[model samples]
Target: MNATGRQTDLIEDYVAALTAALHGPARVKARMIEEIRDGLADTAAAHTGEGMPYHRAAHQAVQEFGTVEELVPSCQQELTIAQARHTARAVALTAPFLIACWYLAQAADHGHAWLLPRTAQLLAVHLTGVATVAALLAAATLAATGALARRMPTPHRLPLVVAWAGTTASAAMAVTTLAFATVSALTTNWPLLAFAGTLAAASHAAVAASARACRRCSRLPTT
Candidate 1:
């Protein structure tokens, strides 16, 4: 049964204290609280079925749930890895955009006019292959890091840092390449070049935001 009567107050107080001791995303915190309440309520229901009164069942349930102190460390660690996994997934999704944007910028600048008929087709093909490799490496790195975050008992600290570093580096490369394209466009008055640069700028912005989130997750204690 759901929390009812005195059980509600007791569960609320316990969850509040548990939340105060834990640090993570709000969603995870709320989920943990919900799960605890559900378990406690079930326990209380079982006690009441044994002929215990409502108030006594609630207290008994709380007692049986054990001390929150011992649960806090594990909860915090779980939240940390989950957060890292989230960032890794984000990196996987966006890193390809960084690759594509950088490739586009380079091709447009090298070939002129944002890959028009007059653009150098041979050079464009070569840049495409290079960008594909970078994108693949980035994807693999993030995927591995994401898996590590999900299951490893300890933080894959070095690998996680490397993955994020690679992500940021890829974005930085895109920005630098796009800057050149932007300059080339301004000099030649190529409107499509500006669009390529704009996309690269957007990818760079996303990487910057992800970097901040990564830094926060890195601070979590994994031991």
Candidate 2:
């Protein structure tokens, strides 16, 4: 194939790969690809010094633009936000199941004692409330991630710092939760409480990190 044909093929492949990697809304993928293509075209124009044929210029431009692997990290800052959204969806889906488990554990512990029925009921109600909150949080995180993905064009250092801080917080929360869960499981203490707390903390941290990463990505200049 000629240089133009080769460049076209490269662009086509790049778009397809981006679509698969992003796995979010079609509009997002389309917009991202369009930006990348424009960037490549501009870079080629600069490289050629004169306006060469589209194919040759484009091919040279793309070749200079580097491979997909190099580009993905820059793109992945936005993708992190998309991942956060997916994570939120997972959290929402898991909420009811977690509540059900909480109830079942309560029942098993209580046996048929018929005592503390009110307490059991209250616990179940509380679990439901927690689940509802989790669902809401998940939805909010997803929406925020989507919005961040749209607005930020390049990676910024400040956002990355914030994201790292969030990740550290999340790691700390996870460790604490794991410790609590271990204690609760071994001693039959507050397993449900520990588990719920851990999950919520971790989810929040993940969302924060994702958002920060997206913001940082927006600051990076495209080639």
Candidate 3:
């Protein structure tokens, strides 16, 4: 009903939507909400001495402060970095398990004959998986770099270089994974190989999507 009440309601709704949309630890979402509120409050404070009505003042404050969508991407970028860090840790932890699964699949397929040395087969599979993971990491890094490049004032050429590198790495990894899976399926009929190929493709797609979003966001003029 009052100006303060209206502003408070708007902030509450915005924060609620943000909390629902952000995907990360609870603390990250809380911090994002607080930062948004402080940004809006600071904008409002700047206009407080202008003698505007409370409702008008708050509306102007929010208008000048910009919308949640604009601010949310920066927060999402931070969340993406956090998630990537988590993925790196998880990859490190579970790599051994994946290696074991590869050997088990190979052994099961071979009727326990042990034609290929188990150690050698495990090493090959580990190398393939590691290469796939490395490609995805390169893609993610390139996408972030591209996004950062778009934000710079002078249009630095390095982000574009990184982006191109990432794209090439992602495509190569996806193709390699698919080819390996196809060969394994035809020779050994291992379905897990197909699954690994799919995972590699999905990771590449995510990196591409992030790069595109970052590029778009970078084009927007800063407040």
Candidate 4:
């Protein structure tokens, strides 16, 4: 093969190995790979400019880029942050729909009366309160990881916080929803019950997936 062909093969092999070694959100991982590839290309070009052959420059670039083990710590940190952000976003986005499901079920139960049995009413109120708090926590977590990231002093343990908190909140919401659904089943219409159930299931799935990502990110070695 020509020097250019050999250089391309070497770079591609290195990138493929790196890619196989890391795991995270697909978009975040793809971006990281592209960024690394670009940096490698730039470094190789610099080496070539200094009189090195193309293939030799590619080898030098890969050497400088470090092995998968070496790159993983910093890359995993970014992935962890991405996973945390994803979980927070999932929780924030689903909060309103979940809240609305409860109200909708209540409305279907009482028509225009907008009332529930005393016990149901109390449970609903408490659930709403908890859900609201969880949503707020998620929003705050998102802000801390994003908009307020630079201004705010973020804790080093933020990813772990996100993993545990997000899992708890999401699981709580799911459990509460199932419990409320069971309690209101007799009073709530089948249509609304099905709708609320579907929404709850979807929210749970999204949040669970995000939480799993956060958990995986947490297990990675820290830089």
lDDT of each: 0.60, 0.54, 0.52, 0.78
Q: Which scores better on lDDT, 3 or 4?
A: 4
Each candidate's TM vs. the true structure?
Answer: 0.65, 0.42, 0.44, 0.84
| Runs with alpha carbons beyond 4 Å of true place in candidate 1 | 1-6, 25-29, 112-185
Measured with C-alpha atoms, the lDDT of residue 136 in candidate 3 is 57
lDDT of 1 by residue, 1-223 (tens): 5546556788768878887777555687689878988898899889899999877898888888877776676676666655555555555565565556545556545644543433434434543454455456556555655565467534357435633664554455464555546465555645655666566566556555555655665565544
Candidates in order: C-alpha RMSD to true structure: 6.2, 9.3, 8.3, 3.0
Error of 4 at 39 (Å): 1.5
Off by over 4 Å in 4: 1-5, 111-126, 176-185
Better of 1 and 2 by lDDT: 1
What is the overall TM-score of model 1 with all chains considered together?
Answer: 0.65
The true-versus-predicted C-alpha distance at residue 202 of model 4, in Å, is 1.5
Please provide, for model 3 over 1-223, each residue's C-alpha lDDT reduced to its tens digit, 9 standing for 90 to 100: 8668987777567667766656543565578678877876666666677776666656776677566677666666565444443433333333333344445446545654433456445545655566456445544544554465377532333233333434443454455455546545564555665665555556556544444433333333332
Question: Per lDDT, what order, best first?
Answer: 4, 1, 2, 3
Model 4: lDDT to the true structure: 0.78
The superposed Cα distance between candidate 1 and the true structure at residue 119, in angstroms, equals 21
Q: Look at candidate 3 and give me any clashing residue pairs.
A: none
Residue pair clashes in candidate 1: none
Q: Evaluated with lDDT, which candidate comes out highest?
A: 4
Model 2 TM-score on a 0 to 1 scale:
0.42
Whole-model lDDT, model 1: 0.60
